[model samples]
Target: MTQIIRSLDEIAPNYDVLFCDLWGCLHNGVAAFPAAVAALQDFRAQGGRVVLLTNAPRPQQYVAAQLDRMGVPRDAWDAIVSSGDAAQDAMFAGAVGRRVWAIAQPKDEGFFTDIPEEWRDAPPITRVPLDEAEGIVCCGLFDDLTEVPEDYRGRLMLARERGLTLLCANPDVVVDMGEKRLYCAGALAELYEDLGGTSLYFGKPHPPIYDLARRRLGLDDNARILAIGDGIATDIAGAAGEGLDALFITGGLAFDQFGPDVENPDPARLAEWLALRAQDPAYSIGRLR
Candidate 1:
């Protein structure tokens, strides 16, 4: 059974490190959550280290810039890790091929900056049509706010016909952008997979990102790291995969399934829902506060 807590203060002292999620747990797409930021500040004041782990397709510096723009305090976290970093590292290590088709908005080109010039093959990192590419790297949709997974059926089908391997930079299906939900790269990846295409996910619920997080924190395998996030499929499942405890925040993207009141979701129903998804979060809260 999951403990429905009112605040993270109740369990803050139990962990040495906090593997915090950035998008949904700390903020919506537009602004920072004051309470969540304050909670991390207080946790760090007590000597605990907080690391912001995000599935953002860009590197940590890009995410830091966005967080600073949104007024998420610098002192709220000690370090940052992103799925883009993992993907870039994989590309550099020769895990992914060089002739690539990037499927993302123009603003998302930062995700490929780390691919060394010497390592790339001839005609590297093209934004051309999928038919002309050897592999695919999907950071996100060209327009997340206006598009859904259905909007990419034709493109995904074409990619499937070519048998291109896709590398999904972000594993989140959807995220809350203020009050509205925006489709993410994971939704498109899922659609591609359903159409018999192979996809390599780079973020949460995958081993590579967690491995990077653990190394960034300089922690051993047995460290008491607590992962806090709103997504059960990504955050909670990721923590469980890495043998860490997780705290599920209900006020983020999963608010609809929780109940009418986002702040006070029915615990019984939430538990049943988690059970249905085969997720077992050690603790749950309406919000990070």
Candidate 2:
């Protein structure tokens, strides 16, 4: 039986580090959740370290700026680690050579800022035609608001025919933006894989990002770190794979499936849902507060 927690105060002392998810748990795509911020502040006040681990395809600085714009308190977290950081490491470590095709928004160019001048050719990362590219880097949809994954079928097929390896910076398929659900870079990557194309994903549910977070937190291998997030496949599964405790937030992406009672969900239904995914979160909460 999973314990349903209404307040994080109940388990704050049991863990030393918190690996918190940003997109759905801390805020919707539009704004910050005040209670979630307050909870992290209170946790930090009690000497617990909070690290924001997100699947956002952009660099940590970009995520910080977005958090600031959304009015999330600066003190709510101690550090931020993003999938883009991991992807940058992969790119520099010879994941993709000089010339590459980029399928991302203009604002997501921060993923390539870490590449040194000498390592890259004239144009480090190009958004030009795929035919002139050696590899592909997908951070997000060219236009997420107006486009879906299906819109890129033709492009993906072309890349597949050329046998280009696609590096997916973000592994999340969808994220809740206000009341609407937006497709992420992972969706496009999945489509590419379906078309017999090779894809390298760098994000949650993959061990690399968790390893980065563990190093950032400076915690021992056996340290009690609690991961809190809404995505069952990404957040909960990632934590479980890392052998860390996870706190499932039902109010985020899983709210609709879990039901309308954000504060209290049917235990049987919740258990059944988790069982299907083979995940067992240490604790379940409606919201971070």
- TM-scores vs. true structure, each candidate: 0.94, 0.94
Q: After superposing candidate 2 on the true structure, give the runs of residues whose Cα lies further than 4 Å from its correct spot.
A: 114-127
RMSD after Cα superposition, model 2: 2.1
Per-residue accuracy of model 2 over 1-289 as CA lDDT, tens digit each: 5688889999999988899999878999888888999999999999999999999998788999999999998889999999998887777666865578888887987777656444565444544568998889889899988899999999899999998999999999999889888999999999999999999988998999988888877878777799999989899999888888899998888887777687787788899998888888999998888
Runs of candidate 1 exceeding 4 Å displacement: 114-126
Q: Where is the poorest 10-residue window by lDDT in model 2?
A: 116-125
The TM-score, computed over Cα atoms with residue i paired to residue i, of candidate 1 is: 0.94
Top TM-score model: 2
* Range of the 10 consecutive residues with the lowest summed lDDT in candidate 1: 118-127
Go through the candidates in order and give each one's C-alpha lDDT.
0.86, 0.87
